[model samples]
Target: MQKLTINLALITPLIFVVMYIIPLGLRDLWSPDEIRYAEIAREMVSSGNWTVPTFNGLRYFEKPVMGHWMNAVSQLLFGENNFSVRAASVFSSAGSALCLWLLVERFITRQMAWISTSIFISLFMVAAIGTYSVLDSMFSLWLTAAFSAFFFAFTADNSAGRYKNYGLAGLFCGLAFLTKGFLALLLPVIVVFPFLLWQKQFTSILRWGWWVIAIALLVCLPWGVAIHLAEPDFWFYFFWVEHIQRFAATNAQHSEPFWYYFAYLPLAILPWLFVAPTAIRHLGKHLNLPLIRYALLWAVIPILFFSLARGKIVTYILPSMVPLAILLAVGLSSAYQKQTRGFKWGSVVNAIVMALIASAFLILYYLGYLPLEQGEHYRPWLAFTAFSFWALFACLAIRTTTLEAKICCYSMMPVGLFLFFWASIPNLSINSKMPAAFIEELKPYVTEKTILLADHPSTMSALNWYLQRNDVYLLNSKGELEYGLSYPDAADRFITQQQLAEFIKTKQNNSTLLIFMRGSALPETQLPGISKRFQRGRFSAYYFAKDTSHD
Candidate 1:
């Protein structure tokens, strides 16, 4: 075990690089979420307006301002690159891991704490979201910190410590509120109150919970009041559209069946899921204990609550993974000490799955079924190499004598795979899902004076973020920008294809106009004087320089 500890201490830095840091810049910012967040942050930095969040210079009330501020600060520190864009999320994920480590250490053993931290970081969903330029990881971080603080306070040995930790929890709750809005307050209330009630310490809420509320409100007051004063309707739109309608309406955004997370969670947990059956069985023996009970309540309740909501996304359940990591770590540790076959079976399952994947890649490549350009011949071998390493490591894990060594090997399995994972993404998916690559090539020709246009707000956002310009016009459809586009001031830029023709006629002959359209976008019959055209995968870009043809 000590040897495993020393190895982990040495390997942790490598894991950080392989799993977390490397992914930040491996691919261009993915559409809507990544580019959307990055643009808002860029605008926040450029416009010097931190109070209101804007996307392409339109009022976007979908979320609160704290996340943009974090991203903005990251951009400031690191300049406008992929690392800066995703730095906030990466740091937030690390923060959550640290908070989990602290709780596991106090409630369980230091060894278990280390194991839990390792497991949490290695989990596929956690690592994936951590490096993505989105607000979910930041939101999950605050939720984890707040919940951990509450747990510490509830279990604290004395009064002063309890209040201090409670205050800390409230502070995080407020920051979480800032990150994603009332959700920060709602989720904790749903979990903590029930937990305190279950502890038969419900009266403690009457005595001390008021202080928590006061502290949270105080922390949120500056931003909350500022936003309300800045845009009086923000609270109304955000509360009704983003919260109420999104959660309860029949036509809520991203609505899915209750089993949505139930299905994706296994994928989220990945190799750990191979062992979860045994781990859960082992942990079941300790469910009645206070620490385990508290963690369980924290993990399970939010999933049920979110399931109750009409709308759902995989990331919505991310905070639930925190206590889950603790529970799984404890359970896995128990099973390891008991010398059960569950661990060996887990390694065997991981090996089998990886081997099958590697074999499938080879079969598909040999059969010529893979969608690859001639130049992408290397991606197949790269993927095979990655999956083969995964299978090899899993076999090593099973053959390894020590529990710590086995778990360490299991944890490192994804690192080799992730190294090649980005390189292995097929160009087909890249063309549709990731537009930044296509947009980056066109960025050199664009300038502040250039009129950029796209059929989709998602594509427009990519142009906006990549070109570092907010004036990218949405051609024909407002999409998510519907509410923002309805305002009279935005009428000039958000126009139809016919209007685009008339609009371009008024521009100077030297002026540049670029249109980016996806595979499904209607063919252009109205666009005139196309000088140059570029087609990449399913996307087509048409360039116009007014009565001049460079073709």
Candidate 2:
């Protein structure tokens, strides 16, 4: 146990720092999510209106204020860069892992705590989203905290401990509520109430649930009332459009087939694929254990809940990964104790799978199917090299006698795989996904008085962020901006590609008109009076000089 403790203590921090933290600032902020979150946070800081979140100078209430608040605070501390943008998410994941560690140590075993925390830190989705600028990681942290606190509360021997833990649970619930929305509060109720009923302690909720609600309400009340007072229609849109509509409406955003997460979850949690088979087998025997039951409830119930929701995204199941790490760690620990061949066989399977995938990519690249542009000459080689190393490490895991060495080697394999994959992406793909270079090229043209326009909101967030100007008009004016643009005050900011010519004619004489059309090229005839155009990779920027020659 001492060796295991020291080993995990070293391994987990190494994984968090190298695998998660270092890589955060290494990549450009990907548009739509990363840039959107970054911009919202940037705007929050710039506007000094932490109560409300506005994207591109318009009211955006798709989510509550806390997510932006996190990023906003990070930007203030870390100074408005990629690290600042994604710092909140990394910290959230760390906090969540710490919470899982405490819960497992208290209920399960100290060894299990180390194992679980390691697994949770390096879990695929957790590492991926936790290092990106997104609300899910932060929201997942609060959710994990609430679940852990609730568990602690329920198991407490005395009323004081119980209520105290319950209050902490409620505090997290309120924070979660602010981070996302009503789902935070609702998800806990569904997950916990059922667990309590199973224990025939459902009556306890009636007695102690008030503390949860009162504390949560107290935490949320200030912001809740603040937003309502400021926006007046803040709850109306957030609740009806975001919450209810997203959950049930036919035209919900990102609606997928019911089995979407079920289909992708196995792939998302790929590193632990080796242990999954054994975990399933071990689950029945451990089902009687209270911690196991709680973990199961915590992990599975949310997946089921999110799956049922019409508007589902893979990140919604992040909270599920916490308990899942606990479950996976315990399962592997049991297999080690029993001296089973499960670990060896699982490693063998992983080795074969990784080798096969690496071989397939090499073969494809050899056949000239995977072409690389001039600058990315080494991309394919780097990626395949990473895959080869992973395959080699999987084989090494199989050879190791101790489970600690095996799990460490196995879990850390994805670090090389993912970092290499991220690093080796073709420059063309990079330029398209991350348009910072293109935006920077157009810097001289963009001024305080320049009339900036983007074809879509997907491209607008980066433009608004990189340029540090949000008053830019939208040509498509759709998606998240759809809600913001619907307001009458946003009318002047809305313009379509078809109407660009007429709109440009009105302002072209007085203000320099710069339009960024992303993904596709628009016809010259449509762009009307353009004096200069800058084309970079997949993006095109049209510049109309002040007082254009064309009528």
Candidate 3:
């Protein structure tokens, strides 16, 4: 057991280095969440205000400051670069891998832990959250740490200091809540409840439950109370509106069908998705192994809960990966036990499934389902093929009922390493519009005092962050007409088209630049002397002349 623990310990660091450290600087920071979080950290660092996070001088209170604080700490230590931004996740994911190793090692075997950890390292969703600079990675990290702490507390001997362990678990849960929000709290309830019920230890479970809640609140209370005192509106919106409404009822247009997450589950839980049924079959029998049963509850509850929710994103179901990895490990070990009869067929099934998947995508591409030139076409196919080949190779390499099965399963390490760097990471870093392709053209036109005006107030929060400048303006014409009219400094601040014309007439005494949306017609008489620069995509910037700047 000790030797197995030592072996699995070696795998986590190796996987971390291959997935994170090697490709540290290959890509530029992109938009939507990446730059938004980066900039929030940047702002937090600059303003010395950790309570309320602002973006481009707007009241941006969408998430807590834990992720930004993480980036800030990394930036302080490592210096602000792509790697620095992602460093928090590096430690988080590595720690999560360790948790997986220990959990499996304690209840099952070291072999299952090692194989499961290897498979987890390659899981597309896991790689996506852990390697990239995002909220999910940090969230995943805290969640795993908390869950691991909780598991150890429950199973530790009386001599092992159970209270302290549970307390530490609560602390981790608090950190997890701060990292994202209520999802961290919601996760443990759904994951741990089933196991307690199954064990028929409901009384003992309730006895220890209050301490956990107290510890969680103790860790989380300072931030919660402080935020509520500072801004009740923020507390309400963040906790209730954003957290609760988002899942309960679809707010922010984030609504999806109930089956949306279920449909995406195969991709999120890939490779392991097929083995989940087997794990389910053995769940009742595994009650003797607390850790394995804990894993079953951990994996199953989250999928069931989130799948039934109105809100769905690929990331919403990520917490399930932890238990899923364990179940897959158990499944692999079971398969190894059954390997003696005429070469196990699961490898062949994996290969055929992958080949079929690849062929399906290829057929779709040819049938106009996928655009040949744009969208991620060939890479996903490559990724699937790589996954299939590795699974097949691992299955074939191991002799039935021997240690070779354990050794060969470690092949998932390389397979995961491949899909992340070659497939998932690149797809997110490069293919998404989050990374600006027009920065080269747009940079030259922007000067130190350049003011970017957008028809939509929140048009490109990421772009504003990428430029590292907050001198952007928004024309409040959508629904803030009366609210906008109240601002006394109309000439220099954001205004409506009529206000824009009036401001230009009064203030445009020199050459001024204006970048506005495509099809937004400028007044024929206003800004007439502005020299027209060529339009780029959806934006056109003009050099305005003083006299013709107004109607």
Candidate 4:
């Protein structure tokens, strides 16, 4: 059994990598988030200045430098492709799973550790974030590691080891801060402080030595100080505008109601959602366990904390998954031991939930509500998921009398989910807008000397990354680039409509200007000699003719 557990431990991560990591470069980098971060890292590499992160050659201080740094390093090694861009996030997420396993193993049996790690990786949000190019996974990794380290510190037998553990925790927290920002530091404190208080470890909380702070400051402050020295305005923008104003105002465009997470958390843990109630109930019975209280606090406090903030994004509550995974493992482990009737019922209910979700998509597809391109292609996968769920339910209902058999049956669901994502998501093309064919068509019209113009460049961030140029001009719009374009060197990059008209009027000899604008935003009075080169979806591309005598 021990050997089997060890084999499972080794095999699970390999499966995760094949499912999550291997497909990093398979899809085109999507817009606004994936492409934006990729372009920033590309700029960091090109500029040779890692301290100040930039998007499209303008200083972008919206996020800290560590994510860019990691991405930059990945790009350096793998070259700037989808895989390189997302490699950091993938590895970070894997690291997070490993940390969870180690942390759980410290408190529970190896079997439970395996269960926790499996649950963590199998989470829909966790797996999705692992594959995407984003900072949240990396931030979650460091935050989880920090919390794990702190847990060790609090439970340490020797004073010397405790201090060392605390320092390691601080270092991970600092790295988390570098990855995202203050929230990295804030999340750990919110989780750990209350947990310590609940455990009546007041002395331990108070004795969280000064060296921990010093170590964290040492890791995080150098970058802050360096960026401030390089760009004096960075601190104000990062701390005030990006953090404070973003939270305080709904104008940041990510505003959701206070109950947003309440609605989304269950979805984030799909297939596993039905298992959560059993976990919470089991946790309630074991409140005296330090780890149980810690896990509960860790999971619940972040939700409450982010709920208070007006700007709510689903990813903001990602760290909660770690504790929730622990709780699930605990509950499931207990259920496994007893072969409880509740576990059987939970499996049946979970299958029903999965079937209902899949059936809804199938119904939508059949009803013509979902797009044919996505729905028709994805329908079979949805059917497969629903079928697998019911199959597992039948197996559990009829044949699975033992705990191991039930677990094996339960594992089939995530395997089906993995296959569905692997086979179906790329075909849907939901994330990608600038198709390769479109890019290839546009490539022939562009040259080094040609200027690319977009009315709203933010809408086409993928173009910036794919074109591999920073000289793309924005016409009569700043959008998200406003922060970066506000820098003195970038001021000339923003052009007014009048200036655009002037440029069209006085075309330079042998110099071409290509403009990409929304089809709706196209000028009512078209320029006389400008020819519409290509029309794809919502975007229209045009080239200005040198001689305007003939319409």
Q: How large is the C-alpha RMSD of every model relative to the true structure?
A: 2.3, 2.1, 5.3, 3.3
- Residues 216-263 of candidate 4: C-alpha lDDT, one tens digit per residue: 999988888999899998888888987887778767558878899999
Using Cα atoms with residue i matched to residue i, what is each candidate's TM-score against the true structure? Answer: 0.96, 0.96, 0.80, 0.91
Candidate 2 residue spans exceeding 4 A from truth:
1-6, 548-551
Query: What does candidate 2 score on TM?
Result: 0.96
Give the better candidate number (2 or 3) by lDDT.
2
Find the candidate with the highest TM-score and give its number: 2
**lDDT of predicted model 1:** 0.85
Q: Which ranges of candidate 3 are over 4 A from the true structure?
A: 1-12, 250-252, 274-284, 340-344, 352-432, 455-459, 475-511, 514-551
Ranking by TM-score: 2, 1, 4, 3
The per-model lDDT (C-alpha) reads 0.85, 0.85, 0.63, 0.75
* C-alpha RMSD between model 1 and the true structure: 2.3
For each of the candidates, give the backbone clash count.
Answer: 0, 0, 4, 0
Please provide, for model 3 over 331-434, each residue's C-alpha lDDT reduced to its tens digit, 9 standing for 90 to 100: 55564455432224444455466667546655765687653345556655665566555555545433224443443444352454444435433333343333
Candidate 2, residues 461-495, lDDT tens digits: the string is 87888989898888865767888898899987888
- Model 2 has an lDDT value of 0.85
lDDT of 1 at 179: 92
